[model samples]
Target: MLTEARLVAVVVTSAMAGAAPPGVDDDAFLAAMAEDTYELVAGLDSVTPVLVTSMPGMEEIVWPGTPVVEIPDLSGAALVRAAFAALPYGEQAVLLSGDAPDLPALLIGKLFRALGRARLAVCPAADGGAVAIAAHLPFPDWAEVGFDDHDPVGALRASAPAPRTVATGPGWHRLRVPGDIARLDPGLEGWDGTRALLSG
Candidate 1:
């Protein structure tokens, strides 16, 4: 009896839900973010989507059957640690920023593929942060590096004792402020939740 190894993708939505750019409705914005995160991860059939947040009632946002891990500490590595603990069944984990709704599915697929060759992989954000990170179980120290500020990805790479074990995947846009809207491509079909709300 052989069971498939689980690969969990933990989507952190607290950041997106807490901050909405000017002129956007808060509820609509959060709904779009939640919808987009599920939609983006849904495109990757091999991975299971999990919601990790300190905020209560977030479970209602993700698709049914999706697990939610509510942690009191979401700072830096603690966030990853909680996710790692929540999904003990997962042999591998990918931390996804709930904000990158428009990120292509292929880029996320690339992160998992990159992890195949390395212990750690990061999908760099255009803002110098990270949109997603892939790491095998028994997490590496570099995985603890804070994914905040302007250069968390750079910091993660530098923290790696073995640079070769850290891999980089295709970069993508991570929406934060209103100006970030410029990076969104009009042709992308999957981020409909976000695009529809912002279309007006």
Candidate 2:
């Protein structure tokens, strides 16, 4: 999938900040998210992936191979914009949620291949949000991204020129609440870190 594609997966997220999800506190949430980011970086071995964080000194905790991109304390669209801007222009820039750890390596390849056909592609979450986005170069003004709004997936669709859609199932779900973890299967391959954290 990355043969001639300048693909970079920007794991866009922050440390635990808001209310804790059920069955876990802020610390556990942070750990779980770290594991998620770790696996994502490890899984995408072909394309260089980076973890975008607002927290200082997070590089030591994230997966070793992946690099870290720190922004000046931003959130929502601003944070996403900063992360994307830091990376060199690529044929495809995939913005992924660090909290959604269950994405297997196969799915990551599929998303990149889909981008080859469209200027932009998104794997929409079941809740009208987005779990991942693969956009072709010359990124749009992220301020209009409308993150945390009612329908960010819809917003992205409108911003690009006929953006393509990638199919996703339960495995692609994002971890918002503690119960949302149930959507993942610890037994599955490539999610060892998340499995260990959630199981223990």
Q: Which candidate is the best by lDDT?
A: 1
lDDT, candidate 1, at 120: 84
Q: How many residue pairs clash in each candidate?
A: 0, 0
Whole-model alpha-carbon lDDT for candidate 1: 0.71
Tell me the TM-score of model 2.
0.77
Tens-digit per-residue lDDT, 1-200, candidate 2: 45334555545455333324545556555656666655665556667666666665567666665567776766666655666677654566777766666666666666667766665555666455666666666666532452344566557666644545322222266666666666776766665656665566
Angstrom error of the Cα, residue 117, model 1: value is 1.5
Clashing pairs in model 2, backbone N/Cα/C closer than 3 A: none
Tens-digit lDDT track of model 1 for 1-200: 11235454545545555446678887677767767877778666777777777766677777777777777746666766666666646677777877788778888778777877888888878867778877787776445654554665566667777777888888887776667778888887777888878876
Lowest lDDT sum, 10 consecutive residues, model 1, at 1-10
Off by over 4 Å in 1: 1-4
